[model samples]
Target: MVLLSCLQRCIQLLIWPVYILAYMGLWDSFYKRVFPYIMARFAPIYNQKVCKQKQELFSNLRKFAGPSGQLRLLEIGTGTGTNFQFYPPGCQLTCTDPNPNFRQFLLKSLSENPHVQLERSVVASGENLHEVPDGAVDVVVCTLVLCSVTNVSKVLKEVLRVLRLGGAFYFLEHVAADQSSWTYFWQKVCDPAWKCFGDGCSLSRETQKELEKTNFSELNLRRIHVAPRWSPTSPHIIGYAVK
Candidate 1:
């Protein structure tokens, strides 16, 4: 028993570095190409389930956004620019991602959509957003990105800094399981493996809690389960917030 315990600890100790490297080399490439393809094919179905929620979000946004209906929107992890189709017309969209391959694809997609002015940069969450000015952006959108960032608090702070007062932060994310038993089991069993292959996505992260810690005001949050054909998990949190 003692030998087995020692072996387990040793193996666990070595997992993180191996996980990080594998994430950069293998999973990044796979996600850049494959995730977009999967999302593009299924976007119609996915959009249908979330239409009501999106309507509520847009309703609230329209009230704050004023008559021009033109807003400066920033998307943190604009993977292959799949979400661009959802943005209201007259949005000046700026997208950033660390993956160069994904950025190229995102730019190409942006060109096809003439309404959006594309700015591509190799930016990762928790890093400085020097290109975007403080209090300049009207809206910030993050979907399924908090799970992958290196430091959630830092990224949230940067997001808050960029948005003007009364500006909103829109998000749709998968969070830590609310049920402790299921959360513990997944955390114990899958987190290490998931961190390796899922690009630092933590199955146990409570994104709502993290958002609450930020400076954003009048936060309206909703939680929903997203049944994606590709993802094994059915319960995901989909909601929006205001800055």
Candidate 2:
């Protein structure tokens, strides 16, 4: 407990500097240029750890082919295109991210994964995907996104607005640990600094609860614990909601 307390204090100490950077408006630029590289290195490890779960969740995507007979998929927070490998071949993918720097990396991934063609890449937030038409996509995907969004409910509302009738929204996100657990205590303790350094990721957001309140016609969410229990990001939920 002493060591944990020390760790918590250290994290708290780091956030003041992050606040200063953000105040100066340098934080967004810094994250834009650097976060893609960071995810490039971290994604493989995370993908491997969640490989089975991703396969299970992604497999349930209804094959609602567009007029072109290709699955139309819109992936919000398409950081570095990390989930590209798991997408079905011939998917007409539209990608979105608040950070524009990720576009090059996304294009690189698109070139490498020739089977999935890019319909467009928009520099937009999850809460405002106005460029995408109503019922424009057959599937919407968001992985590790809800924790960082400014408004989770608004994003969910936008998601429902954009999906075609019977369309599915598949999400995989690390959420707040169970309230009675040791991890939950640490998550609350570390959230302030985590948001500062993690580009607005909240360590203790009850994302699953938000999903429950969303009016999806069918919701199938499951809570599971990933390995490395000491990490605040270990507790996760993966599932889909249909419009």
Candidate 3:
């Protein structure tokens, strides 16, 4: 029985990579586009939880942004522009995504919200945000985005480059489990395949450790089990840091 179970596990691990690659190829074309639309269409069902969290994050950000509401905010991986509604009226917002398919959705959201100034561009990750000037942005916001980037360290470095001194970087991301041995084992076993299907997202990454290695200071970390948005069993980490 033990030998059979071990063989089964090994087979699962071996087949995972192929499945992940196929999944990612299909996801990049289909899931990435449709997922945002589905999320927006079903916003009412998810927004209560998502919005509450956004409100809290934005509130914390407001202390740094000040009374003028004149924040130069940059959002990386701004899919479907769902986060546009969360910003205050006077924010100078720029949203970027590698996928050009989201352009119309971004424009529509910007048009509806007259205060927002929109710029659509193809940025593969934070490293590719050369169009945005260094130390120009007051705040950098990333929600559920880091997992898909090709190189997280490069992305974080780029984030540091664009943010002004004392500026804040806010992020909401789901990462690899730390406590559960079984979950961690599976995350390690399936990461390569998972990345293939999930837009280069690694379930084993410790985002906080990456943040600590960056130039940022005053890191505030929070953990929450984001129920049933994407992965049913995964937990999420949300935090902000000063650059």
Off by over 4 Å in 3: 1-47, 66-69, 119-124, 189-193, 228-233
TM-score winner: 2
Query: Any idea what lDDT model 2 has?
Result: 0.88
lDDT of candidates 1 onward, in order: 0.68, 0.88, 0.73
What lDDT score goes with residue 160 in model 1? Answer: 84
CA RMSD per model (angstroms):
4.9, 2.4, 4.3
User: For model 1, what is the error of residue 86's alpha carbon versus the real structure, in angstroms, after optimal superposition?
Assistant: 0.8
TM-score of each: 0.76, 0.92, 0.78
Model 2: ten consecutive residues of lowest lDDT: 60-69
What TM-score, to 2 decimals, does candidate 3 have?
A: 0.78
Error of 1 at 199 (Å): 1.4
Clashes, model 2: 0
lDDT of 1 at 30: 62
Prediction 1 TM-score vs. true: 0.76
Clashes of 1: 0
Q: Cα miss at 87, model 1 (Å)?
A: 0.5
lDDT comparing candidate 1 with the true structure: 0.68
